[model samples]
Target: MGSVLAFFVLATVFFYNAGNWLVVSHLPQRADAIVVLMGGVPERIPEAVDLYKSGFAPRLIFPDDYEENPPEVLPDGSLLHNDAAKAMHLSSHFNIPDSVIVIVKGPALNTQVEAEIMAIYLADHPETDTIILVSSSYHMRRALIIFRNEFASKGLEITIISVPSRYTAFDPEKWWQTAGDRKTVFLEYIKIAYNLLWDRWF
Candidate 1:
C-alpha cells in the first residue's frame, strides 16, 4: 500500500509539467499578417487584435468556422454570437478598421483543417512571407508544429511566429486542481498522441 502511494505521488509530480509541455510562447514581430486559430475566442482573438493594433501585422486572418452552424439572426435582424462576429465586434469596439480583417472562406473544424486552409490561402498570396500564429496558451505548441508541417508539405517557406494567448486562466503548475483544467490537459495529451499516430500511420 505504501509503495503504491509513493508511486502515485511520484507520477503526479512529474505529470504536473505536462501543462507547460503543451505550451509554446514567442514574442511577436512585424509580420505580413496575423492568424488567430479558431476557437478559444475569448483568449485568442483579443491577443491577435492587440498584436494588429500594435502594428505587428497589417491584416488579421481567421478561418471561416461558421459553415456548419451559420450565424443566427434575431428578430431585430442582428447576428447572434459566433467567433467571427465576436471578433468583428471586438475589432470595432477597439477602433480597428474592418478592411484589415480577412476571413479565409473554408471549413476549419479542427486545428489540422485550419492549418490546411491557411496554407491554401497563403499559397495564392506569395507576398505574405511572415505571419504571427496565435492560439490558446495550452494549444500553441501543437498548432505551431502543425502549421509548420503543413506549410512545409506545400513547399511554402513562410516564417511562423507563435504567440500564446495571455488571457487564459490555466496555470501550468496547478492544472490538475480544477476540473476544467484537468479535462483540457487530458484531452490535449490525447489529441497530441492521436496526431502523432495519425501522422505516422498515414
Candidate 2:
C-alpha cells in the first residue's frame, strides 16, 4: 500500500509540473538579433518586440512562410500579403522600425523548419553571432533544442538565448484546470516526443 501511494504521489507531482518542465527561459542579454518563432504570434511577437525595444538585440528576424500565408487580393484591389507578416505588422504597430526588421524567407511549416531557415539566413549575414530566441512559454524547450540542433548541423557556432513569451495564456501551476491550457500542454508533449524520435533514430 505504501509503495502504491508513493507512486501515485510521484506521478501527481510530475503531471502537475509538466507545463513548467516544458518551459525554458533565460535572462535577456545584448545579442546580435532576436528571432521569434512562428505561431504564437499574439504572445511571441509582443515578447520579441519588448526585447528589441529594450535593446537586447539590434534587429529582429522573422521567418516568412509564403505557403502558410500566401498573397491574397483584398477588396481594396491591393495585394495583402499576410498583413506584412502578422508578426512584422504587430511589431511595427508596437513601434519597432522597419530598418531593424529582417525577413528570412522560406517554407516555415514547423519549428524545425524555422530554425533551419534562420540558420541559412545567418550563414549569409555572418555578423549575427548571438541570438535571442522567443516562443510560447510551453513551446520554448522544444524550440530551443530544435534550434540548437539545427545550428549545430549547419556548423554554426551561434549563441542562442531562449526567452519564453511573458504574454502566454498558459499557467504552469494550474494548466490542467483550463481546457485551453490542457490542450496546449498535451499538444506540446506530443510534439516534443515526435521531435525526439525524429532527431534520435530517424
Candidate 3:
C-alpha cells in the first residue's frame, strides 16, 4: 500500500509540472489585434506591449473591467478606474498611441464577459478575424477555453500567449513544494472542469 501511494504521488507531481508546458499554445507570427485580458498583475501589459511593438498586431484592445462605484480619486489624483489606469500606463509609459490602443467599452468583469464584449466588437469591425490573447502563464488554459467557447460560432480565431507573473507564488516547476502553489493548481483544475461541464450542459 505504501509503495502504491508513493508511486501515485510521484506520478501526480510529474504530471503537474509537465502539464504547465502543455497549457501554453503556440504563438502566431501576426494577428489582427492583441487583446490583453485584464486581472493579472501588471505583467500582462508589458507582454502585450512587446507583442504590439513586435508588429504582431496593429491594435491593442483592453476590456474595461467592471468596478462597482470606484473611488473618485486615486493616489495619483487620477480618476481612472483600474482598467483605464492600465490603459493610460500603456500609452504613457510604453509610448503606444491612443489611436491604436482601444479600451473596449462594456461591463466585462470576468473572462466570459470579456470574451463576449470582444466578440461584439469583432462582429462590428468585421476586419479583425484573428486575435492574439495575452494573459498569465497559469491562466492561459482556462482563458483559452472560455474565449474559444464564447467565439466558437463567431468565425474569430484566437491565439493565446502567456506572460510570467510576479504576483503569483505558484511555481510551475515546483508546484508540489508549497501548499499555496498546490492550492492554486488545484483550484485551476476545478475551474477548468467547471467551465467544460457548464459549457457542455448549460
What Cα-based lDDT does every candidate model obtain?
0.85, 0.86, 0.74
| Model 2, position 123: C-alpha lDDT score | 91
Which of candidates 1 and 2 reaches a greater TM-score?
2
Q: Cα RMSD for candidate 2?
A: 2.3
> For residues 100-184, could you state the per-residue lDDT of candidate 3 as single tens digits?
8888887787888898898888878878777888777677788888888888757765444443433444468877787876777
- Steric clash pairs (candidate 3): none
Tell me, by TM-score, which candidate is best.
2
Per-model TM values vs. the true structure = 0.88, 0.90, 0.82
Q: Compared to the true structure, candidate 1 yields what TM-score?
A: 0.88
Q: How many pairs of residues collide in model 1? A: 0
Q: What is the lDDT of residue 176 in candidate 1?
A: 88
Better of 2 and 3 by TM-score: 2
Q: How many backbone clashes does candidate 3 have?
A: 0
Indicate the TM-score of model 2: 0.90
- The true-versus-predicted C-alpha distance at residue 60 of model 2, in Å, is 0.3
| Residue range 22-77, candidate 1, lDDT tens digits | 88887788999999887877788888888987899999988877542567575778
